[model samples]
Target: MPELPEVEVIRRGLAPGLLGRRILRLVIGEKRLRRESSPEKFQEWLPGRVILDLERRGKYLLFRLEGGVTLLLHLGMTGRLLLGPGPSPPRPHVHLVLELEGGLDLAFQDVRRFGQALVFPPGAEPDPLAQVGREPFSREVTPEWLAQEARARSRTIKNFLMDGRVLAGIGNIYASEILFAARLHPGMPAGRLSPADWGRVLKETRRILNAAIAKGGTTVSDYLNSRGETGLFQLELSVYGREGEPCRRCGRAVARISQGGRSTFFCPRCQKKK
Candidate 1:
């Protein structure tokens, strides 16, 4: 799945070309995505509307169009949004294509068909936004806030960090990295964390997320920028995907464990359980 940083990278990459362009037409594919609005709905709300702005909420991309209509996209595991000149050759797994006024085409391709494309009319709030919590970079997010939210919660710290309802845009990859940086064990119960512990987690979360965004996100598999470029952050990974490799800090073998069915990588010596 494309997490916060990956989605943010896409938003920044596409914003320059997408803003102010009018949607000339909608080319719908025969195959349907996991969550998509009807072709009639898309055609009715999208064509002839100019793209006013591009925004990202959690892992969802929001294309604000003229007359207050919003185009929402969620790039599931293997989804890619590629932009190129029109009259381009047909590619496989392209489910939606928006023909722009400048002869440019914005195509959404997902081999697994798990992505989402939805259109929301004026005054209608996107349903997916309701599920997204505060962004990690928000000033409102503080150690005190995290402590309050995790109060009485028995879930593991890793699971707490991965919960989109509490902190938006965090997934398995960043969760492991953030916990590793904070020197906190993934299996530690959420309620057991002190305010100082939460402070370290919050600081490292912002640091790692900003670094990932700067590096254009981690491309472990199918992630690509609008220009079809792979991310460089994977080369800087510390623990994730480095199972049994020596830890960069402690020189101890990096460990991998399963939490909530997702692999979590950390240093056992550094992130000792309390």
Candidate 2:
């Protein structure tokens, strides 16, 4: 699935073309995504509404439309939001296409069908947003806040970081990278981290996320920007997929371990368990 940075990249890429463009029509695919609004609902809320703004909350893309209707999208694993001049190519696995007024088509393509496309009417709150935690770049996300949330939680630091309800938009890829950058073991208990340790984690989280966004996000697999360009951040990865590779900091072998059923890559020498 696309994490925060990847989603943010897509939002930025699509904003310019989407804002002020009215949805001319909806081209619905035969197959359905994991979570999607009904065709009737989509048609009722989306067509003819001009896109006012594009925003990203956690990993979800929000298209604020005229009359306050919101179009929400979540690119699940193997999902790509592609923007192109119409007529769009006959691409396979495209679940939805938003035909715009200026001959542009915004298509939601998901090979695995795990993506989400929903439209909320005016005054209706999106249920998925209720689960997303604070943005990593928000000023309110201090080290003290992270520590307070982790209090009494015995989950591993890696698992804790991956929980969207606590800190939104982090997935396995960024979790491993953030833990490695913080020099904190993925296996350490969340509650065991001191405020200083939390500070390092928070700092590195913002740094890595901003860096990934600048590089257009890490495209280890299916992720791509709206322009269909692959991200460049994978070339700069330190530990996420470099198992048995030498650690850049300590010259020790970068290690891989499983936590909460996800692979974690870190330098054992640099990120010592406390």
Name the best candidate (by lDDT).
1
Q: List the residue pairs that clash in candidate 1.
A: none
Provide the TM-score for each candidate, comma-separated.
Answer: 0.98, 0.98
Work out candidate 2's RMSD over C-alphas.
1.0
TM-score of 1: 0.98
State the C-alpha lDDT per candidate.
Answer: 0.93, 0.91
Off by over 4 Å in 1: 231-235
lDDT of 2 by residue, 181-201 (tens): 999999999999998999999
Error of 2 at 51 (Å): 0.2
